[model samples]
Target: MTQKEPAGSVAAVAGDKSSLLTMDFREKSWIKVQKKDGSVIAEYIGKPGEQRQLEINEPVTIIVGFAPGVTMAFRGNPVDLAPNTVNSVARISLK
Candidate 1:
């Protein structure tokens, strides 16, 4: 019997002042973005091989569910996350 594997790892990429943030994943998962005050900024479900863009103005925390073949990039730059990671969180500051 083949055991069903859990979601894969999470990756992140941040954008600069003149660019928009982008995230890409290979599996279905939930994404959440929050501010320093714990207020949610953005939340949504992502599809496989999906790419999302966001415009942030302050420091925020990003939370993503682990899914197989997940990857992320910010402003066209790749952000590295732990391999085979579970639910992950990334803090970003746009100053």
Candidate 2:
């Protein structure tokens, strides 16, 4: 018979399991947001010179909606996007 592991015991044994979870949303390597032309937008990290790889026809979440208007959201967190801008996807890097 197989013995059940205690609660969180497995995670305890794993080294720096905190890396698996982060409170820093800025560290996320992905961007999901709508575009200026009303097209869905998605991008993946790309080569040094190449533009981010875009995924067409994918539904993107509106970061502006997270707060209020585009202006407000940007003003609230310029890190997310430029102030007064609408429907744009920006890649955030953490290094």
Best by TM-score: 1
Q: Which regions of candidate 2 fall more than 4 Å away from where they truly are? A: 1-43, 62-81, 84-95
Task: Put down candidate 2 lDDT per residue, 1-95, tens digits, no spaces.
Answer: 95565775332122333212121232323334555565645433322233222222222334322222122122122334444344443333211
Model 1 spans > 4 angstroms off:
1-17, 67-69, 83-95
Give all candidates' CA lDDT scores.
0.62, 0.31
Clashing pairs in 2: none
* Candidate 1 clashes between residue pairs 3 or more apart in a chain or in different chains: 8-67, 8-68, 13-73, 13-74, 14-74
Q: Write the residue-wise lDDT of candidate 1 on 40-71 in tens digits.
A: 98986888867888876556776666634456
Which predicted model would earn the best lDDT? 1
| Candidate 1 accuracy as lDDT | 0.62
| Deviation (Å) of 79 in candidate 2 | 15
